[model samples]
Target: MKQLRLSGSGGQGVITAAIIFAEAAMNEGKQVVQSQSYGPEARGGASKAEIVISDEKIYHPKIVSPDIVLSLTQKAADKYYKGLDQNNGLLVVDEDLVPNIPDFPNVVKVPVTRIAAEKVGKMLFTNIVALGVLVKLSQLISLESAKKAVEKRVPPHTIEQNMKALQLGYDAV
Candidate 1:
């Protein structure tokens, strides 16, 4: 089974990104389980999501220690990066938000938020770009499947733009 966790502030789209990833995995005939934790407020609060994907049926939905951890904020990074399995896994972080992460052999620092803000005119695309990067690095799912899942999850009018954002992210790193 491949376990992953995504964490960021309340409005960074971490939970939604996890759902989209799980949906894409399910489309590929994998067994997937997803869970989320967040406060009642929609802004300035901690939010996290966990996803487990396996060829066989999954027994538990909770992520004990994620094989991969994606962090968009310093708070999220501080909370989850230490818990990531470094033996053969990765920690993807937003470099713009975090300047110095102690050298972890498996960690990758990407200026995702800055890249999105520069290319897309807002940092909202950070989550999608980060998702694309993870998909590329892990080869967990095809970009085509992820794009289709995003289309299904996003509003019709925003689909085209988000797809471009995903592609930009995939190509950026």
Candidate 2:
């Protein structure tokens, strides 16, 4: 089983990213469980979304030691980075948003928000770009499946820009 935790501020689309990731895993015939938590504030509050994927049945929905953790903020990195698998795990962080990354062997530092703002011309596309990075780094889900999920979840008018953001993110690393 693979456990993934995506953490960031609210309105960064962490929950939506988790849903899309779960959908992509499901598309690959994997059993996926996704859950989320956030503060009362709608935006700029701490938010976390967890996903568990396996070929076998998933009995527990919660994740203890995640195989992959994406931290888009310094607070999230400080809170969740220790929960990663000690021996083998991947830590992905937004370099621009997270200034202090823990000392981890398998850490991937990407300027996701910066890339979204500069390449896609909107910071709102950060999550989609992060999704693309996750897809590329983890290889747990196919790009096609992720794209399909994005198409299904995002607003129709923003599909083109989101796709561009996704592609730019994929190309970044």
Candidate 3:
């Protein structure tokens, strides 16, 4: 099984991104389980979503060791990055938001939020871009499957921009 944990602020849409990723994995005939947690503060508080995917049945939903850990905020990054198995796990962080990134063998630092604001024209698209980055980095699901999930989850009018954001993230890696 491949376990992934996505961490960010509450309003960054990490939960939605995790759902989209789980849907993509399901589309590929994988067993998937997703769960999330958020602090009391509604918008800027710490948030995290964990997803487990496998071809076999998922016996346990909780994540013991994540293959990928994505952190979009300094608080989340600081909290989660230290516990990862450095030899095996890949760490991803938003370079703009996380300044003091940890030293890891496998790390991808990208300005996900800035890409959404500048390229996609709204910070709301950060999660979609991050989803694309996760798909690209992990290869857990096909990019085509991820695109289909994006189409399914996002609204009709915003599909174009969302797709653009996904591609930007994919190419960013």
Q: Give the per-residue lDDT digits (tens) of candidate 3, residues 1-173.
A: 89999999899999999999999999999999999999899888889999999889898787988889999998888888776897888899999999988877878899999999999999999999999899999998999999999999999999999999999999999
- Per-model TM values vs. the true structure: 0.95, 0.97, 0.97
Q: Which stretches of candidate 3 lie over 4 Å from their true place?
A: none
Cα lDDT of model 2 by residue, 19-127, tens digit? 9999989998999999999999978899999999999999988997898999999999989989877779899999988898898888999999999999899999999
What does the lDDT read for residue 165 in candidate 2?
Answer: 87
Candidate 2, residue 84: the lDDT equals 78
lDDT of each: 0.86, 0.92, 0.93
Poorly placed runs, candidate 2 (over 4 Å)? none
The window of 10 residues in a row where model 2 has the poorest summed lDDT is 78-87
At residue 38, give the lDDT of candidate 3: 90
Best by lDDT: 3
lDDT of 1 by residue, 5-46 (tens): 998889989888899999999999999999999999969799
| Candidate 1 deviant stretches above 4 angstroms | none
Question: Cα miss at 72, model 2 (Å)?
Answer: 0.6
